[model samples]
Target: MTTEITIELDINGRSETLTLDPRVTLLDALREHLGLTGTKKGCDQGQCGACTVHVDGARVLSCLTLAAQAAGRPVTTIEGLSAPGGELHPVQAAFLEHDAFQCGYCTPGQIMSAVACIREGHAGSDEEIREYMAGNLCRCGAYPHIVAAVRQAAEMAS
Candidate 1:
């Protein structure tokens, strides 16, 4: 028999309760259980940053973080990044203005990581931005534009 445990989580600024298999990943819990599909399942491994989310304000790989391990921490997915009433986060706006994505498969992760990168003080230069954002791989090869977006957002935040 499968065992399930109930846990309460603060997600996207709201309180959430879930009864789930202990083995379920935070990524699966967010996407499969909570129906927040913005955090993609790109490689299903930690190798890809596509599953990135903010756990207590730090970027984390949801796929690699067990749901139980995230209990009681406030989690923020891409859907939660925007201000209430549908205003875009500055990073999101910068991405749009910079044309940072092509097919956009890696966009949510890129934006999430970019926000953290800037907040972490890693967006100081183009090289630094590249190094900091190295984990998020864009198949469309939009590195230049992505860097521009991050820089723009960083400047805007300053």
Candidate 2:
């Protein structure tokens, strides 16, 4: 018989208890089990940053992170970035102002990473922003605009 473990996760400031197989990834737990689908799954091997989410304020790959491993930790998905009053996060706003996305498939990951990039103090220069955001792939060639958005958001934060 397969063993199922019940774990409680703090997601978006809410407590969610799930009973699932240990193999279930945090992506599946958020998208499949909890109905929070903002965190996309791409290049499930972790090469692409599409499945990025913040665990305890640090970004991580949900695709490779087992749900159980996140138990007792705070998980913030794309949906959690917005304020309860419906205001967009600074990075989200900057992306809109800069038109930093095209197909939008990678925008969530990019935004998530950009937030971390700014918070981590790595958005000082264009080169630094590019280096910090290298992990996120934007097939639409929105790198220039993305860098601009990150730059703007970083400036706003400072």
Candidate 3:
């Protein structure tokens, strides 16, 4: 027998109701069920921040978050970072300008975490940004460009 739970997700200023398996992780529900593939799945064990998303304005690893726990909470993924029609968020634009990523596998998580880092007043310096973003690992070793991008985004945001 299959058991399903109804969840209301306030995603990107929109409310969506979905019936999902209680065992489903928020990452799987977003990617597989909701088709929000922008939130990548790397190291599904939560060691990697590839599945990062904003829950109630705070960055959380979606891979470790249960879908049921996110009900009625605001969940923002990369797809919701910018306005519709592909307007890049300032951080995203800065990342592009700085060439902050290579394979882009971890870019989504990096950007998500960066946004939160800046919002939480943790982007005051490169060292601070690096320390705050330490959870999101980029295998490309693009820390320099990533730091540059975050700094630029912080300037733009301010």
Candidate 4:
């Protein structure tokens, strides 16, 4: 037996209506239903920030966010972070320039979180950026570069 519900999400500046099982997390709905695979599934328990996404301009763990909980809210994934014409967000450009990722599995989430960290004014210093971004783990030990990327993006955004 299964129960399903419909939800309307404004993802990445696009509006999408999805019918999903109640148990379907926002991550599954985005990756499975919408084919937005940039948001990785890591430590599905929400301990890892791999599934980070912005819900109404605030960062959230998609793995633990229920699809229904996101209904009628603007959801922004890694795919939605840039302009339509492939214009990289400042954070994205900084990440690329700094080579903040090694394995790359955690890049999307890290980028997403980095954007939020700057927006939330938590990236004012290296230690602040590190603390705010601690949730997003890089298995390849790229923390230094990640911090540098956030710092660079923050400086550029100012």
Candidate 5:
């Protein structure tokens, strides 16, 4: 018999408790158990940035992290990126304004990573932004737009 563990994840500014299989990845817990499908399942192997999310305000690949590992930690999904009243986060606004996404499958993770890249002070230069955001691969070749949006967002935040 598989042992199920109860984990309380603070997601999107709210506490959501669930009794889940210990082997379930945080990505599955967020998308399957909690219905927070904004974080895509592109690779499911952590190679693609489609499953990225913010854990404790840092970018994390949910596909590689177990649900139990996220217990008691604050998790933020794309849905949480906006203000409660529906105001977009600076990165989100910039992404939209600059059309940073094509095909739209990788937008969530790209945006999440962009936010962290800027917060970590790596958005100072285009080269730095590319270096920091290298982990998030955009198959649609939207790197130019992505970099532009990230740079714009970083500037707006300063």
Candidate 6:
């Protein structure tokens, strides 16, 4: 049986309504239903931060979030970080400047979490930022550059 639930989502800057299966995860809904594939699915069990996104301006693991539960909340994915005109967000720019990503598989989630880390005042120091950003792993062992990028983005944001 298919249960259609209508959810109002503030995706990026636009408001949208979608009818979806209640069992669908926010990650799946975003990628499969809405075609927002920027949020990658790594572990899918929430262990990996590859599925990170912003919900109501806070970082969350999209793979673990229920689409129905996110109704009426603002969702921001990596694609949304850039303005419609194609200007990169400060964090995105910093990532490039620091060469924070190698394989690029985890870059989206890392950037998303980094944005939240700065916004939440957790990026105060290199050690502190590294500790806070520990959740998002970079298999390429780019932690140093990742930390630098986060610091750069934080400085730029300030």
Which is the better candidate, 1 or 6, if ranked by lDDT? 1
lDDT value for candidate 4?
A: 0.93
Q: Each model's C-alpha lDDT?
A: 0.94, 0.95, 0.93, 0.93, 0.93, 0.92
| TM values, all candidates | 0.98, 0.98, 0.96, 0.98, 0.97, 0.95
User: Model 4: per-residue lDDT, tens digit, 27-54?
Assistant: 9999999999999999999888999999
The prediction achieving the highest lDDT against the true structure is 2
In candidate 3, the residue pairs with backbone N, CA or C atoms under 3 Å apart (3 or more residues apart, or in different chains) clash, namely none
What lDDT is reached at residue 99 by model 3? 98
Question: Which residues of candidate 3, in runs, are more than 4 Å off?
Answer: none
Q: Which stretches of candidate 2 lie over 4 Å from their true place?
A: none
TM-score quality measure for candidate 6: 0.95
Better of 1 and 3 by lDDT: 1
CA RMSD per model (angstroms): 0.7, 0.7, 1.1, 0.7, 0.8, 1.2
| lDDT assessment of candidate 2 | 0.95
Give the C-alpha lDDT of model 6.
0.92
Per residue, candidate 6 scores C-alpha lDDT tens digits across 20-90 of: 88899999988998899999999999887999999999999999999988888889999999978999999
| Model 5 CA lDDT for position 105 | 95
lDDT by residue for model 2 (2-112), tens = 799999999999999999999999999999999998888889989999999999999989999999999999999999999999999999999999999999999999999
Give residue 149's lDDT in candidate 2 (0 to 100): 96
- Give me candidate 2's TM-score against the actual structure: 0.98
lDDT of 3 by residue, 24-122 (tens): 999999999989999999999989899999999999999999989999888999999986888989999999999999999999999999999999999
Off by over 4 Å in 6: none
How many pairs of residues collide in each model? 0, 0, 0, 0, 0, 0
